[model samples]
Target: MPDKPAGMRFKVRNENKNALGGLATRKQITIYFTQAVDAPSMEVLLYLPNHVSGPVPAFAGLNFSGNQSVHPDKGIFMSDRWINNNQKGIQRNRATEASRGSQASRWPVETLLKNGFALVTAYYGDLEPDHADGWQTGIRTSLQQELNLAPDQWGAIGAWAWGMSRIMDYLETEKRINSKQVALTGLSRIGKAAVWAGANDARFALVVSNESGEGGAALARRNYGETIAQLNRSFPHWFSPAYKNYNQAPDKLPVDQHQLLALIAPRPLYVCSAAEDQWADPQGEFLSAVHAGPVYQLYGKTGLGTAQMPAIEKPVGETIGYHIRTGKHDINLYDWQQHLAFAQKHFRKKAKPKT
Candidate 1:
C-alpha cells in the first residue's frame, strides 16, 4: 500500500446487528482530520452480509442522494447535508422521507448480500455538494483551512475521492471486511470520482465506472458528447480552475482520460456505458480503455483487446473491462452483475470461505 496521507482519523459512531431484516449488519462511521478540531467530518454507512463467516470483500462508493435512499431502512441517517436540489426526494438542500429508498433499485443490496459481499456507501454531498458554492458547506472548506491549501489545489471531485480514501482507511481496521479486496464504484459524476480515487489509491482491488464519460473514462479529445466547454459551463466546480483553460481546446490539455485509465494499470478496472446515453460518449469510453491496453501490457497483463466496442450486455476484457449495456443513463442490475462477476474473477481466490 502507498504511504498513508497525514492527519486522518476515524471513529465508529454507531453499529447495529440484524439490520435489514437480519440480512446484514450496519455501522455508521465518522471520518475527520486530526489537524483541526473543527474540520468537517463525513459519515459512512457500511453493510456486511450477516451470514458470512469471516471478513468479506466489499464495494465502496459515493451515493448521489442521502444514505437512506440506498435502502428503505429508517435506521439509515436522513441527510440534512447540502445536496443538488435537482435530485429526487431532495428539496432546498435537504432530503425528505419520501426520498428514502428512491435509489434502491440501482443499488441491489439484496443481491450483494446473497453473493457474500459487503456494501459501504456515503452520500457525496457529505463531502461536497454539487454546486459551485458547495465547497463552503462541505469538507473542502475545513480541509482547505486545515491543510492550508489554495482554492485551486483541488475541486469537488477531488474532495469526494479523498472521502473514499478516508473510508478505506477506516475499513483497514475492520475485522469483518477484507480491505484489500474492496472495490470502488459509482454512477455518472460519482463514477468519475471512483476512477480518480482508484487512480490515486492503490488500495482498491477493483474500480468500476458506470457511464462516467467526458472527464471520466471517455477521451476528452474525442469531443463526441458533453464537450469540455459544456461541462465547464454547466458544472464549473467539478474540476479545478486550471481545467477551465482547456474548454476551448481539449487537445491542448496535457493529459486525457486514456491516461487516467492508464494510471490504474495492473489493477482491475471496468468501464460501463448505456446504449442511449450518448451524452456520456460510450464509444469514447471504450476507446480510452482500448488505448490503456499497452500500459497493462507493461505489467504483463491483458487489457480489452478489441478496438471496437462489444455488443450490448456483452462485457469484455481481462485486466480492463468495458461494456455498453442496453439501456439509458442509469445503473441497474446488469451493471452490478458485471461488476460482481469481475470482482469474483479477480478476488475469489483470496476471499474467505463463508461459514
Candidate 2:
C-alpha cells in the first residue's frame, strides 16, 4: 500500500457516548495536513457499539448525503459540504433539517450494533463534491498542490479512496475499534470507491461493492450496461483523463475490472448486485469475480468459483462472496445481512484458547 501522506494530523473535535438511543457512542474526528493549511479538512463520524465488551470491528464507507442523514440523531453534526443537488433531501447543494434519517433505511445502525459491528462513515462530498468543478471546494484541490500531482494523477474516486485510508489511520489510533477487522463498503459510485480503496489499501480486512457497476466491479470490456462512454459522459470527474480514452475502445485498455479485483486477492471481497438494477450489469460483476479466482488461488484462497451467475437472492462464493439480491439499485437490510455473515466467517476474532 502507498505510504500514508506525509504530515497528516488528526484531532478529536467532538465525542459523545450517549447517542443512538443509548445503543452507540458517537465521535467526530478531524483530519488535516500540517503543512497544507489551506486544504479542506475531513470530519469522520464513528459509531461504536456501546454494549460491546471490547474493541468492535467496524464497517467504513462514503455516504451520499451528509452524515446527519444516516441516522436520526440530534447531536450528530450536519455537514455544509457541497452535495449533489439531485440527491434526496438535498436542496441547493445543502442538507436541511428534514434530511435527517432520510437515508436510514440504507444504514441500519441498530441492526449493525446488535450484530456486533461499529459503523464508520463520512460524507463523500467532504473529500470531493460530485460535480466537474467540485475540486475547487474539496480536499483534492489542496492535495494536488501539496503533493504536486498533475490534473490526471487522480480523480474524485481516488480522492475518496484515499480519504478511507485516512479514516483507517484514525481508527488504528482509537482503542474501541479493531483496525484489523474493518471492512470498507460503498454503493453505486461510492461502491466504486470502496473497491478501489480495498485494492489500494490492504489494511482493510474486507471489502464490499454494492452495485458498483461499469467503472466499478463490472468488467469494463463487457460493454453491457453502463459503458465507458456513458460513465465518462455522466461523471467525467470520477476517473482520470486516461480512462476516457478507452470510452470507445475498451478492448485496447491495458487493465480490466478483473485485474482490479485481483488486487484484493486472498482478502475477503464481497461484490453484490441487484436483479432489477440492470444498469449495473450483474453478470459482468459476477464474471469479474470469477476471473479473479486465479489470483486468490495463488494465495491458497478461493474466489467466486462459478462462471454462471447464481439465481437471484442466492448468494455464492467463499472468500470472495457475491449475491444478486432481488431488488433495485439501493442497499437494504438484506445486503447488510449478507455482509454480516461474510464478516462473521472471515473477520470474527478467534476464541481465546477456550479458557
Candidate 3:
C-alpha cells in the first residue's frame, strides 16, 4: 500500500480590487477577470445582500459554462469563451439543458436573502475546461512554473479550485460580504473542485459536494463508477500525470476521496448524491462521507449522523450532511432545496438593521 499524503496547507491570494467600490452600500456586484484563455474570459456572479447594518454570509460555486447560461440574464453578456458543444473543451459531454435555471428555482434565493446571506458563482470553463491542454490554454498556463515543482501540482481540479480562490478575492473587496462566513460549493467535477478549494482555503467556512464521484467524495479504492482509467481516458487533463498511473491500481494510490473529504475536517461539509446516478456511484459517495465523519467528530462536530445510506428523497442531516435524491447524473431543484435548508441550519443569519 502506498503511503497516504499528509493533509497539505494552502494560502489564498487575489489581486487587490475594490472595483465595485461605492457601487452599492449593499447590492450585487459582478466582475469579469481576463484569465489566460483565448476567447472567453471568466466572470464572477455575485449576490450581495442589502447591506445589513452588518456583513452577510455567502456561498460560492463553479458554473458549468459562462455565467450567462445560469439565468439568461440580459445583464450578463454573451461569452466569447463559449466552447461549442461538439467542438473542444469537454463541451462534448454536455450536461442536460433542463438542469439550467433549475438550480435557481431550487436554491430558494428569497430564502437566502431573507435569512441574511448572499450567493456567488463562477463558470469553471473560464479557468480550464476538462480536457487535455486545458491547463496550457487557461489560467494554469500562467501558473505552471510556480506550481510545477510539487509532484501534486494543481491539474484540472487545481485550476478550477484556483478559479474559486479568485472568486474569493473578489468577495473580500465587497464591504457587505462577510468573507469569513463564505461557503464553497459545486456539483460533479466542480464538486471535486469545491472540496479542494475549501480544504486549501480555511477562509471558506463551509464546503458542499453534490454527486462528486470518484476523484471527488468516493473512495478510489472502491474503483466504482468513473474509475481512474475512465476519468483519464474521458477527461485526461483533470488530474496530474501521477494520477494516471493509479487508474486500475486504486489500492496503491496514496490518497482516496475519503481523505479529500477529511481534508475539510473541522469545517462544515455536506455530500449529496442521486439514487439513479449509479455511474457516479452514489453509494460510494455516501460511504466516503461516512468515513470522513470521524475526522469531524475529532473536532467536536457531528459528522454524518448515521452509518446507513438513506432512501432517495430522504436526507439525513449532520455536520457532514449526506443525501441521495431520486434522479440521474445532474443537479436538480431537490438538491438545491436541501443545500439551502442545510445552510440555514448551520449559518448565522445576520439581520438587516432598522431603517
Candidate 4:
C-alpha cells in the first residue's frame, strides 16, 4: 500500500446550506495530493451533522453512480466524470440533474445525521470506472509508476481501494468528524474494495461489508454461488491477471477468504448478506466470518461467535458482526440500521477509558 500522502488537502467548491432541513451541512470538495492544478484530483460529497456537540463518527465509502446521484440536491456539483450509460438519470455517459438522488434510498443520509454520524462518499469512477477501458481515463494510468505493481498485480480494485485511503486523508482534516471512528462500507463489488481497503490500511478503524460475496468475504473454496471462474469471466478487470489461474480451482490456491478476514483481526468487521441474493452465497459469507474466529481469538477479541448462520433479519456476532436480511441483493435501510447499531457499539467501546 502507498504511504499516506503528505500535505494532502481539499478545496471546498461550495457549501450547500439547509441540507436535510438544517439537520446537516453539505459540501462538495475536490481533493488533491498537492497544490498543482493539473495533478490528479478526487471529488467527495460530505454530509456533516449540525446538532452534534463534538466530532461525530462517520461512514466513508465509494458510490456506484456519481456523487450527484446520491441525493437530489440541486446544489450538488453535477459530476463531470464518466458514468455508465445504463445508469439512471445519466445520459451521454455524464451526470444530469435528472439523475440526482436516484440512489438516495441506498444512502439514508437523514438517518446518519439524526443519529450523529457524518457521511462522506465519492464516485468510484473518480478513481477508475468499471469497464475494461475505464483505466484509460481514470487514475490508474496516472498512478502506474507510483503503484509499481507486477504484471500479475491487479489495479482495478486496488485503485478503488486506494481512493478510499485518499478519502481517509481528507477526513482527517475535518474537525467535526472523528476520523478514528470512521467506518469503511460498501456494497457488491465495492464491498470487495472496502474489505481490501480495510485490510491494507488499519487507519480505517472499522469495516462493513454489505453482501460482498465471492471475491470479497466469501470463501472461494466453498464452490458456492458466483464462482471464481465466473467473476474473472464477468468482470475480467476486477482481479489480478494471475488470479485467472485459480478459476474453477479455488481449492488449489494456498488460502481461502478466511485468511483475508484474518487480516482485520482485533478490529471490528461486519459481514452482511441478503437471503434472496443466492448468487452472492449468503451462507458462504457467514462461514468465512465463522472460520476467521481463531485470528480474533489470538487478540482476545471475538469473531462471529457461532458457525451456524443467524436467523434472517437477526444480526449476530461481537467484534465480527454478521447478518442476513430477508431481502434481495441490495443495500437497504435494514442494512444501515444494523451498521449504525454495530458502529455505536464498537466505537463507543474505544471512546471509553481503560483502568
Candidate 5:
C-alpha cells in the first residue's frame, strides 16, 4: 500500500525438509528489502504440504512472537530480534529454547497439512517490533520518508499489511504454492493488519480477521466495545494518525468498519469473535458483517445475512462468513477449523487427490 518494497528475495528454502517425516516440509525464507538495504530483513517460516502434489493454497499471517514460538520443530530458527520481554520463554528480549512451540496449540499444523494447505508466517517483530519506538529497528525507519509517516499516514498496521503483500510476492514465484488461493489471516491486532492488507491488496484470495476489534471488523460506529478513543490511547502506533481525529467521535467519521469489509467484496472474508471477548464487541462485528452483505449481494454473493449473531460456536455465511465462538479473545483450533472450511468452500479447494 505504501508503495511496494524495493524488492523481495528469499535467502533459503526447501532445505533439510525431509526431517519432518515426509508429511510436510518447513523452510525459513529471509526477505530482504532492496530499498532499506541496512534494515533487518524479515524472516518467513513456511510449511509446505509434502503430501500434496502440485501447487497448494497457503495462509500467510503475522505472528505475535518469533517463528520458533509457533511450533516446537527444533529446526525452526529462533528469532534474533527484540520481542516483548513479558512473552513466555523470551529472555532479555530474545527467544530461547523454552519458547519453542509455546503457542503451538494456536496453530493446527498437522490438520492443515492433512487438508492440503501451506502455512506461511513470520514474527510481527520481523518488520517492526510491537512497541512505540519499534520503528527505529524496523523497515519503517529504514524506508523512505513516505513510508514512515508523520500523523496522517499508515503506521505499524500499514507496514505489517504491506509485509503481507511482500510475502505474496515471494509466493507468486514459488511453483509449489498456488498464489491464487492464498489466504491472509491474523488475530487481535494482527487480525486488524490482515483486514487492512486485504483492503489494499487484491493478490490475497481470502482474508480472516479473528477478534480484530475496533479498527478491525468490529463496527466503530457502534462504540460498543474497545471504542476508538481507548484504542488510540492504549496503542497509539497501531493505526494511521489520521484515524485518531475521530477517536472520540466515531459517528462523525465518513466511513466505518463495514466499508473496510466491503473492500474485500465478492472475495471471501471471514470475521470471527469470541463470546467472552466483549472488549472486541462480538455483536458489533456481526453487525458489520451483516451490513457488508449488501455489497456482496451486488456481486451476487452471500454474506452473514443476519442482523443477529449466531449461537456461540455456530459459524454462518458464504462469501462473507462470521462466527462468535465460546471462548476468550484468542485464536484457537476452532477458529482455524472455521477459516479452513470457509476457504475451502470459497476457493473450491479440497484435500489433495490420492496418487
Candidate 6:
C-alpha cells in the first residue's frame, strides 16, 4: 500500500505516558470540545484494558445514544445531546422511554474485557446530530476562519469522524495501550465515522465497518435500500451541500464506497453485514470490499479472501474480514467475537515488544 498521508503519520513522544498502579500502567485524558454550545459537557469514553501485565490492542468506536447509556458505570459522563431517550433527551429531565437499554445487547463489554482487549467509545451526538444546524454545534464551530472547509468539510459525518480523532489524541497518552494497535470500529452511522477515521488516521491499526451503508462501506452506485437521496433528504445536515447534488445520481459521485475502502489499503479492515439488513445493502458492502483488494495488494496484504459473499455466519478472514450474520440491523455477540479473533491474530504480542 502507498505510505499513509503525511498529516496522518502521527509521531510518538516519550512523555506521553502515565501510571495508574504497578500493574495498571496507563493514561487517560479528556479532550474538551469547547466550541459547540447547544448542550452540556460532552466527552469521549476510554478504558485501557492494556492496564494488565502487558500492553494490549484496543477497539475504538462511536456510541449512538450517549456514553453513559453504554454501561452502568458511573464514571462515564451523562450526555447532553437531544437524544430520543425519555430520561435524558425527551420527557424533560428524564431519558426517552424507548431509549433504555437499546444497545445493551450490541455492546458486550464484559465479553470484550475477558478476551483481553481495551474498548474505547464516544457519543456521536456529542459531535453533531443528524439534523440541520448541527454544524453550528460541531467541530465546524471550531474551524479556523482562515481555512474554511470546502463545501464538504463540516457535515455531520465529517464532524463525527473528527471527534474520533480527538479520542485518538487521548489514546496516544495511555501507556497501557499499544497506541499503534488501536482499531477503529463503529456501527451504522458511526460505522461510517469509523471508516472515515481509519482512512484519515494511519495510527489506527485496523478499521472495521459494521453495517455502515450508503456513503459508508456499501457501493453507492448500486441503488441500495437507503439511497444517497434518502440520507440527504432525511438528514440534510449529515453531508455537505455538494453531496445533495448527487442524490439519486450515484454515477456522478467523485468516489464510491470502494475507493473509501481502498483508502485503508494494507491496514486490516473488517466489513460486516447482517443477512436480514437489506436496508443497508449487504451485497453492496461486500462488493466494495472486493474492489478495494487491488490497493491492499500493493503492500502484499490480501484484501477480501473471496469474490462471492459467504454463507450466513461464515466469516472470511484475511487482511480484509467480512461476515453476513443471520440477524437484523444491529451489532451482537457474534460481531464482537469476530472482531476479537481478528485483532488477536493480527495484533498479537510482538516479540520483545516495546511500546
Per-residue lDDT of candidate 1, residues 1-355 (tens digit)? 1233377778888788988899999998877765468657788899999998999999999898888899999999888787667778888878999889999988888888878899999998888888888878766675665556655677888888888888888999999999989999989999888999999999999999999998899999988899999998998888888888999999898888989999998999999999999999999999999999999999999999778779988889999998899889999988888888888889965343322
The C-alpha lDDT values of all candidates are 0.87, 0.87, 0.68, 0.86, 0.85, 0.72
Tens digits of per-residue lDDT for model 5 on 1-355?
A: 7765545456775455564678788878888876345645788888999978999989889887799888888889888899998988998898989999998988888778878989989898888788887777676777645354543355788778888988888898878899999999999999999999999898899999999998999999999989999998988888777889998889999999999999998889999999999999998888888998999999998787667778888888878898889889999888888888888887786643221
Cα RMSD, model 6: 6.0
List ranges where model 6 is wrong by over 4 Å: 1-29, 33-41, 85-102, 144-152, 349-355
Clashing pairs in 3: 40-81
Report residue 129 deviation for candidate 5 (angstroms): 1.0
- Model 2 residue runs over 4 Å out of place are 1-3, 35-39, 349-355
Work out the TM-score per prediction: 0.95, 0.95, 0.80, 0.95, 0.95, 0.84
lDDT of 5: 0.85
Which is the better candidate, 2 or 5, if ranked by TM-score?
2
| Whole-structure CA lDDT of model 6 | 0.72
Report residue 88 deviation for candidate 6 (angstroms): 9.2
Better of 2 and 4 by lDDT: 2
Candidate number achieving the greatest TM-score relative to the actual structure: 2
Q: What is model 4's C-alpha RMSD?
A: 3.4
Off by over 4 Å in 1: 1-7, 35-38, 349-355
Evaluation by lDDT, superior candidate among 3 and 6: 6
Report the candidate with higher lDDT, 2 versus 3: 2
